[model samples]
Target: VRGTMRHLLVLALAAALLPVASVAAEESDVVVLTSQNFEHDTQASTGATTGDWFVKFYAPWCGHCKKLAPVWDELATELKGVVNVAKVDAEAHSSLRKRFRIRGYPTLIFFSQGKMYKYEEKRSLESLVAFAKGGYKDDTEAVDVPAPPDLIATLKGEFFGLLKTVLHYSKHPEAISQESAYFLAAGIVIGSVLASAFYLFLSLASPAPAKRVSQSKKGD
Candidate 1:
């Protein structure tokens, strides 16, 4: 009776540990990569030459990234044969971040055929699987504007429109007033110069990752 009880206890313990062992085995296949290893892995795989798509951007401190980690891991496991999932820490790899122009944390950048698309918005195992099966289509709406015939023609038309307006005011100087016309032209020139400078300043003011992280910390 004592031997039987011991045998039963051992079996129960093994049964409990079996699932944990299976889970560990599944996790073992999932790869976690740093920024330093990203480029080398990408080059070696050549963007998963065997019908595998690559997801290559993440940030460790991001809540969204942490939330998505398990989903991403499941995706890797589910699509092991179909696609290869990889990650890079955006904060750790300044060079990679600059090279890719990563703008946000938890950004999922998909790579295939030497091209990359930023996977913006919510990420889940299902969504990623769908993206892998079909190509990732950005959620942004594209507005198509027809190009003018030529740069010279477009500039000429703009110049003529301005000239015509000026001529109208000049012809009716008594009605519109010369002072008003001079002031209007001056205001237009000044506005254009100021607008240009403002845009230039904004472009230069774009924040770096480290700066953004520090700013976020201060805000918190």
Candidate 2:
């Protein structure tokens, strides 16, 4: 009989703790965003899609960010099904940091209906949760989220592209080999000469506009 009572008490205790475990699981639902997938995921939230996002642009070592970590977790749990809570490590992802022009450590941005609303209020759990859950409508300051960067163009610019390479080598001559600098200069000169030759050829090839003449009739 004692063993049976013990089993019943253990089951009751486990039932009581199940909610705490569930809450812990919910808290971990905050999405971790990096530069690669940032635009794709955020762009999906625009224009009638249900996954509106509340994103925290934070540095991992920032003191204020560290302080708000738990509250941010709680906010995610509170607004789980209503709004998607996500975070980015700006210190690690320099591209996103530059893209958003994030100057501060912990910047909160809520994206909904193709607009971005910066959160400037106090970073309490209530404030964060409220802002995520349609409280952003009260604020008058909102801006359209910047368009997604073209992957191919971005890759080209980051690596070796014609114009970007020319500009870079022109501005910072010490960055490349001497042969590369000479080639860049030659490319610029050749491009200019070709453009001028094309203009001259077009001018000489096309006929001039015809002139209209009017004369009085002698019969008048």
Candidate 3:
């Protein structure tokens, strides 16, 4: 019983601290635009000579969006300071989704020369790189890419995934930081209580020795 309690406590603490790591996992140099900044970031003025803008609209909960996330992050890093590479959460900003005609969860849009261009190409590393660097013509689209089957899930397993989510939410910029802090504090308190209970349970544990007890009755 005490062993089981200890294990549970450890798991609880680990779960609580998971989100802290997920925030870093979710972060990248790629600019994540919210509803407030989507227009300012993507909308270019007439004759505006700013760098080309490559924006990928995604839904946070979309599996396709999840697969595209790392690739988009890489594209942003490679084209950093050369072209503007960013992402918008369509689910979070429904107005932008409707305005841009984002029918799908992972739509790619590029703005350049004071015009908006929809990218309908493959989302592979090479394809995205080429599209961003002006290798593709105005109308080029490819089949969508999907994650591999029989693949080892990211974060090694669900336990780690849960942990990452916890950490990510705890430090999420959009959500109140205090909420996460309080959550972590509560987790710690619960874990400590469980640990104490486990310790006391163990300290008070007294197993009767089968052979010794039987032999001791005769001695008595």
Measured by lDDT, the strongest candidate is 2
lDDT, candidate 1, 75-145, per-residue tens: 88887876678776554334455556678777776665555566655576677777776546556332221
Q: After superposition on all CA atoms, how large is the RMSD of candidate 2?
A: 25.4
For candidate 3, write residues 147-214 as lDDT tens digits: 12121221122223233334445455354234234433443444345445545655576474476444
Q: How much lDDT does each candidate structure score?
A: 0.49, 0.62, 0.58
Please state the error at residue 55 of candidate 1 in Å.
1.8
* Best candidate (score: TM-score): 2
Error of 1 at 202 (Å): 34
lDDT of 3: 0.58
* Model 1 clashing residue pairs (backbone): none
Clashes of each: 0, 0, 8
Off by over 4 Å in 1: 1-28, 44-51, 137-220
RMSD of each: 31.4, 25.4, 16.6
Candidate 3 local Cα displacement, residue 9, angstroms: 38
Residues 22-114 of candidate 2 have per-residue lDDT tens digits of 111222667877655677676733453657999999864467987887888888888888898988866545556666778998999888888
- Return the TM-score for each candidate structure: 0.46, 0.55, 0.51
* Candidates sorted on TM-score, descending: 2, 3, 1
Q: CA shift at 29, candidate 3, in angstroms?
A: 1.7
| Candidate with the larger TM-score of 1 and 3 | 3
